[model samples]
Target: MAKRENIGLSRELRQTENRAEEEAWQTLRLLRKEGWPVRRQHQIGPYIVDFAITKARLVIEVDGGIHREQEVAARDVEREGVLRADGWNVLRVSAQFARHGDHLIEMVRAEIKRCCPLTLHPSPQGERGT
Candidate 1:
């Protein structure tokens, strides 16, 4: 059936993305297992977030600083604009974060603490209330 075929195609597409996502997920999971809740490769408007914590409405990107050249940076800035326009916080982690031990973990932890307060529970003072 056409529906079955479509499902198969969808599965294939997801698999392709999953492989790339896994590399990033492995690093994030290390922090998550320590108590920071994270979602792997979530979808935003016209983009797939490398990691997202919806509870904090934060998007975390594990970039290798591979976006070289002005054009690439411009595109990234534009993408960020789109994301920001939608009321989301963005965090870009570089090779230093995950490649080294403990440092990246701490950074992720701090970000979660910061963003979490903004998401699940908002306070009247324009910050999330505990």
Candidate 2:
């Protein structure tokens, strides 16, 4: 269950999302329609991630110019450490790359495949039940 505070924060964050995040969300929505089960502004632990594939334990962060600041980058590193310790894979994409529709979707798809290849594809008949 999502914490009360995080839920509110997520709501606020969603409302103020940057252009890159908006583009990423559009791609995520398409992936969801294709059965990828993506969620936007999802709460995980004490943080609300930009996008999450819960089953695959993947967190996608669309970083804008602000993320390049030293303080923000440091905080991001700490947050990523915590999430990784909890067994999550974090993928960060720059605002510029994320704003490119095709590139963003392709990158996300590649990450998903890397994280959960077996679940996404069936074993060959000869390899099955081996």
Candidate 3:
């Protein structure tokens, strides 16, 4: 369980998140509604991600205008490398992906399937009828 203080902080962060972050949250919330176990503004190691799929060990980042800066880009690369080394798959999406619409969720679903094939498997009883 999350500490009450941490939970409050998470709520505050969500409330204060930028437009791109809010857009990403909509798509991530859709994933959660679909039972994908997605979380928003989740902390991992020393960093906080825009979204994360806990079971799949996947991190989704929504990059905005600041990411265009050379220093920020370099730091993002390093952050991704560290996450990768720690056995997490990172997906970086542009803010435009969110502003455009549901395409972003589709992309995330595709990445989830690619990274965690077990998510696509049929139940032990066997494949269900079409």
TM per candidate? 0.64, 0.87, 0.80
- Provide the RMSD of all predictions against the true structure, rounded to 1 decimal: 7.4, 6.3, 6.1
Write candidate 1's Cα lDDT for 90-126 as tens digits: 8876645545545655676677677665444333232
Question: Which pairs clash in the backbone of model 2?
Answer: none
Error of 2 at 106 (Å): 1.0
What clash count goes with each model?
A: 0, 0, 0
Q: Taking the tens digit of each residue's C-alpha lDDT, what string does model 3 give over 54-130?
A: 76788988898999999999999999999999999999988888665478888888888899887764234322231
Better of 2 and 3 by lDDT: 2
Query: What does candidate 2's lDDT look like per residue over 1-130, in tens digits?
Result: 4599888889999999988889888877777654576778988888899998776788999898899999999999999999999999999988888888888888878888898888764332222121
Which pairs of residues collide in candidate 1? none
Clashing pairs in 3: none
Score residue 30 of candidate 3 by CA lDDT: 66
- Alpha carbon deviation, residue 74, candidate 1 (Å): 0.9
- Report residue 120 deviation for candidate 3 (angstroms): 2.6
Clashes of 3: 0
lDDT of 3: 0.78
Better of 1 and 2 by lDDT: 2
Decreasing lDDT order of the candidates:
2, 3, 1
